[model samples]
Target: MWVTSSTDKVLTPSAIALGNFDGIHRGHQKVLQPILQASAVIGCPASARKVIRDSQCPYATVVTFNPHPQEFFTGQSKQLLTPLPEKVKLLEQLGVEQLVLLPFDRELAALSPQQFVEEILMRQLQATRISVGEDFRFGHKRAGTAEDLRAIAAKFGVEVVITSLQTCQGNESEQPTLRISSSAIRQALAEGDIDRANRMLGRAYTLMGTVVKGQQLGKTIGFPTANLQLPPTKLLPRYGVYCVKVFLEGEGENIITQSSIKGVMNIGCRPTVAGNTPTVEVHLLDWAGNLYGKTLTASLEKFLRPEQKFPSIDALKAQIAFDCDLARKILERST
Candidate 1:
């Protein structure tokens, strides 16, 4: 897939999905559906499927911003659920042909609703169609609504598709349907509701890091671990114990060495050991070897318990033993 900046040239007659798409959750997929279908039909042999006419056929494109806009406006770095590289991978998997990353700088932020549509969409991209959620907003101060986009783009003979917000049950039954969104996913992660978050994401929420040498605290207690040093801007799930799957991967993070290694992960400061710095460490069940400097991909599966202080090192060791047993049972049942 092609990744472009605002200044870069885009394919003409573009069918664009416009959004931040931070997590590329199911809701975002709904907005992208129309363009994806068009791209698919346009790419295949005409004999296989009905082909759209060249005048109507379009490049499936996504327009999103970098720096999160929030991070740009607030001048504070924000934790990211899907960083740029991950976003590119996900969009490519969904068949997006082009991704335009509008740098969220002061100049772009100053555009009004009229200029954004006429300058960015019509002039720069020459978009033939635009897709956005009903709740979507844009332009300076978020002054442009989805309806506004429809009205403005109509003058240029561009079709606008506005999708309703996608929602899912909050529980098994008798609960409200919550809208699936990036913010909602963040809330789920903050509460350690990994299962719900993954459901919304349509895939495992993977955390990647390099294994670093630690003090061997877990090894001292017969629970040897591989310490992971994560990117500072990654959005971490709540500090706690979790049932997880760890995958060994190549340095570039594209090659998987195995299916997965079941494990229990701990994320927090080691209160019992008098450690104040927060850490993420995993103990691969029934496995032991040097892992220093290796890269790992951890999939948070189930939340077992929140981080807490223990009375003694012996108490902590006992609790860890129990956690391992529970995690094994959970992983087994899940498989």
Candidate 2:
């Protein structure tokens, strides 16, 4: 993708879309549609695909951040819906022509709202138009509001589009649709409410990581697991064993296969084994593989059971067997 770190780089004719776009949920999609529409209407240079290029695109480019602004500002780095790489992947899938991943550092944080527009959006991107949420803020101390953005656009000879918020209630009970937020999504996951989280996310929440070598403890007990080394910045669900579907990346292909193996995933420190740190271990049923040192992406489709202490290994094994059967039933019903 066309990832430019320096804003000083000049670009071809382009419209700009701006946001953190954490989950790229339905609300984000709504915001982006009009930006693309305006780009098409402007008759700018032909849309250039940026799969592997540094050249700026002639059409729409989505500007987002790495080490999320919130993370940089408040040190609240946990509970991310999508990390930079995954967010880029999703944006590309959605047909973004170019992507600018600005590193959110102290210097970028100190620019005044007007300077941000003149420098980044106008001079740097030469943005013919800019789109963002109503709550969008910019410049040092977040002094710029949507009105400020509109004023900047008028002065800079650019158009400004402010998107409305998207909200929805669960299961047709429309008293009031819950607010779309990363915090709300995290709350749902923390409470083991995958259904509610999915409603906010518009898809299942996924955790990706490299599979690490473990002590073969699961195999010894007849339940082999793929131990994942989750990134420190990645958000984790509530501590518990869950029912999940595992997917593996294939050679020369971008598709993932859902292993037929039903499994129970534990998301916590191995208290029973006196482990120091938390681990996510999955035991696949009716399947076997040599998965050491491979990257695996696991999706928590549903919450099956809570984490608890078993008196002995034998007892733990029996409970795990039961959990697998229960997980299979839950997944079967879901399909």
Candidate 3:
């Protein structure tokens, strides 16, 4: 996607979509369809035909925020569905033509919904049309609902579309009718239900960071690992050993260098090793390469067990070997 800093830089007529778009889940997809369809009608070509017409050459843009506006208002707190970079990558994959990242500070947060619509959406983006979820609200106090948007949109010669909530089958086959939200996904991750979390995220939950040097205890145990210094700000799953897939970031055309690997990861302080700090360490099955200064992206696949200290180093080694074998079997079976 072509990312634009400000609305002023948007050179083409635009059909805009609004959302935090945390995970870009199915619910977000429901809202996105109309905007994409409108774009297509306006000569904003589909996936392959990325060209545009002169008058109807509509630019598709998504307006999102940084520092999550909720951090300031809501009592709830947790990791984001996708960080800014990851979010941008996902939007690009979804065929977004432009991305407008708004800095959510005290000043921006205080804008009344009408002012935001007039200044940012109508004037800045020059939105010929706009789409969003039915429940979506904007402006300082979230006083702007679909009705409010429609009322104002008419005055500015803009068209507004409100998408209905998309429902998916939930427990006991009940229809869970709500948009996938970062808050719900965070709760699932906290509970160690990676599968449910993935359902909401529209993909596996991942942690990406630089591989920093750690105490060489894993090497001594014959199971060297790439230690990731996870950001304190990022959401982390329940601390435990899990089956994971590790890959070197920016290695190739592949989003994940390797589709996945049968591997074991420890997500906690090494209690077995005296005085070790909390860390994320992954040992890729049947692979060995220098990774001290490299960056790695590890996606947790399944939670095997919680972090535990074995009686002896031999016992720990034995457990690790078993874990590797189990992971291998699981991977093969899944494939």
Candidate 4:
């Protein structure tokens, strides 16, 4: 989909969806939709279809930043609901023709609202239309507003579309409408509310990582697991055991498996073993294989239980067995 962090070169005339888009949740999707419709993207992202020169045919583009503006400004490492790589894939799936991961650094952050629109939107991106949610803020010291965007873009004959915040129901139809947002999804995950978070995400939340060596404690206990080494910036759900759908992937995220394998994943420190640092490990149900050095994407399907220290290895093993059984039931029924 032509993902670039280039500050140089003007691309084709584009309709850009601008946001942090951490989780690419439903609300973010709303901002992206009008651009897709307005531009009339000619073909799939995989095809790299060039935009037609006619004034009405602008390619769909998404301009977001890395390290998150909040993280950059606060100097605090923040966990992301969808890391940059995952966010790119999701945007491509939504048929974005281009993705500008504008390097969010001191220089870029220093630009005033006027300079941002002139240099970023009008010059480099050549944006014919710009889309953002109502709450979007931009430029130095967060000085830009949706109205400001409209006023500036209008000066260059660029169209600005502001989308309203989207609210949605929880997994259960009877539940009250909940505001769709990255923070809300993070809160849901923190509260162990997987279903509500997934409902807001419009799909199962996935954790992508490479399988690395662990203490071999699970192996010794007969529940050998592939320990996942996830991105430091990735937001993990509450430390607990979960029913997961596991997929083996090749580099660049091409799926290697014919179908998802059901699994039980544990994301926590093993207090019973005197472990202190948090870790993620998954035991693929009814499967036997070495996943060392391979990449795996595990989708959280159901929350099994909160993590707690057990009395002994036997106790932990017994509980894992039950968790595995329950995961199989959930996976089978969902299938």
Better of 3 and 4 by lDDT: 4
- Each model's lDDT: 0.86, 0.76, 0.76, 0.87
Question: What TM-score goes with each of the models?
Answer: 0.88, 0.87, 0.86, 0.91
User: lDDT tens digits, residues 1-335, model 1?
Assistant: 87888545676667899999988888899999987776556655434323343655677899988878898989999998987776887899888878998888888899999999999999888788899999999999999999999999999988899999888767674247777888889999998888789888877787788999889999889999999988788788999999898888665433447788899999989888998999999999987666777888888889999999999999999999999999999998888
Over 1-335, each residue of candidate 4 has an lDDT whose tens digit, in order, gives 77778857435678899998889888998999988986664443333345235455777888888768888889999999888778877888898878888889999999999999999889888888899999999999999999999999999988899999898875555457888889989999998889989989988999999999999899998999999998888999999999999999764444477599999999999898999999999999888876888889999999999999999889988999999999999999999
Model 4 pairs in collision? none
Model 4 ranges with Cα > 4 A deviation = 41-56, 171-175, 251-255
RMSD of each: 3.5, 3.6, 3.3, 2.8
Q: So what's the TM-score on candidate 4?
A: 0.91
**Residue 191 shift from truth in candidate 1, angstroms:** 2.2
Per-residue CA lDDT of model 3 for 1-335, tens digit only, reads: 77766556765667888888887887787777766777776434575346434546577778777656787667456466667666777778787778887777778888998889888887777788888888888888787898788888889888898888765445553346434676777777877877677776666678777788888789988999888876566677877888877767655344336566557888888787764667888898987766666677777777888888888999999998988888778767766
Write down the TM-score for model 3: 0.86
User: Could you tell which candidate, 2 or 4, scores higher by TM-score?
Assistant: 4
What is candidate 2's TM-score against the reference? Answer: 0.87
Candidate 3 stretches with Cα past 4 Å from truth are: 46-53, 73-78, 171-179, 251-258, 274-276
Candidate 1 global Cα RMSD: 3.5
